[model samples]
Target: MTAGNNGTNPPEGDDPFGYLYRSENGAPSAQGQQANSPRRSYNEVRAVGDRRYGQQQRPQPDQSPSPYYAAPETQPGGGQGGSGGPGRRAAGRANQEPARRNGLLIGALAVVGAVILGVGAAFAFSDSDDDKAGADPGASESADAGQDDAPDPDDGPPEEDEERPLPQENGSSLRLENGPVVAGDVEGSRAKDGSYIHGFKEGSAALWQPEIEEDGEYTVFVGYTVPGKDMSLQVSANDASPYSARFSNYAGAEEGDWAKGWTQTFAWVELKKGTNDIRIACGDKAEQCSVAMDRIWLEKGHVKK
Candidate 1:
């Protein structure tokens, strides 16, 4: 009914928690208890965390004041005249240690990241340099130094691949056999003497001995004239198996006009680097033998050139 107990005992169960309210009946407050009061005996008016609970009370050593709940200005020598007590200093140091560790960790991570970036930048620069070198014309030339030189645009296109220079032979150099004759009657001969081998037919042959520079495949070209019809002859080299060498009617000349019927045809052959003998004969297998031979030559590959 009142704010305080007026220094008197309260009624039983009147308010066991009455001390929590304003005490208008004048009972001393929980904070106003003196050193010898009954409230001080039970330590009820002490700070919340001042004593340990659920433990036996024993003689305790004197220790520094707690930093918790203590004001910086109220601790011994903590005012403007002093920095702080040892307790405040210790708590300040403890609080700052985690921040210092975090700062150090962040700085280390930044340094590591910078190193990684530097390495990556170095690799990128190296790759860029390689690419630039690859695109450089001088570098390309050096890389291809062991290969064949490229054709110069001003010098004209590169010549086709040939192992050796072609060799030419005149019809007069051939040894006529079996009704063949070397005469000047046909006027379209490319020989120096304007002569050609003629009258070659079935069972006839013209053999020539020519020199070769290399051992490989070659093309044998025959310059001849046909009277308006396709003709062929049997050819053999080194006494090997004979094969047919066809000569087409490329001149379009009428019958009996050998001057207008001069043309060339070719066949592939194999020869070694030395003297080789070639024979053109109208053998039994020949499709036609009515062709006048004027020249025979060799090219350096399997295809006509």
Candidate 2:
């Protein structure tokens, strides 16, 4: 029978493992020195892991190039013109892929940021346009500011009414009840004839029948004078309850000096929308009645105009 050799042939030497016991065969020991001969070394220097079974032996750095292997300058992917090797080219490609992806990501982010900024600017511009369009351009801010600066109704007097003359009657036109007329005597009398009624010690009174425009509250002003003393006068409108009007010594004059003591006082009264009867008198409930009366007037509101 023939033995199977496959593609390899067996060794035909007397002993293939003889190198393991070469010292017993009179071979030269590495440490022993021979007569007149140089010493031999058994240790050889080569690159670590350069030789392996069924693998090509890598050349040492100090050795010249072998005829079986090509030089680094002539091999593919070895020189500067080509990538260093398959492993190095793959590593370089992997590294370049990350850089490229990062660059693309940065560009995408920049685009998104620009889009967002543009959208925000557009919204801002649109809002500004809408505000301008909705607002009244021709209107003045003074109107709104005036509203804020306006006086509160309860805080102060109301705005002055129009120039329409209020319904009023002077002393000369009014009818006298028990008081006597003093004409052209006292100074600062607003009556056309400068006539005034006075001397209402107990039942003295001045009466008026003035026509009113509407039924509302009215302030009846009496132009009078006191000689350095205060007094309280009685006034009534439309025969309603009487009101006590204060008469102050506004002129600061001496006693019996009715010429220099000229001032006015008022009282609140209600009247109907027609002819209304008004009266001022010094009756039983009167305080000091020694006063010089001059003119009479009416305002529409409870405030003094």
Error of 1 at 221 (Å): 0.6
- Candidate 1 stretches with Cα past 4 Å from truth are 1-164, 285-287
Give one digit per residue, the lDDT tens place, for model 2 in 264-302: 888998889879889888858545777778788888879
Each prediction's whole-model lDDT (CA): 0.75, 0.72
Q: Which residues of candidate 2, in runs, are more than 4 Å off?
A: 1-164, 285-287
Best by lDDT: 1
Deviation in Å, model 1, residue 268 alpha carbon: 0.4
lDDT score, residue 285, model 1? 47
TM-score of each: 0.45, 0.44
Task: Judge candidate 1 at residue 158 and give its lDDT.
Answer: 73
Q: For model 1, what is the C-alpha lDDT against the true structure?
A: 0.75
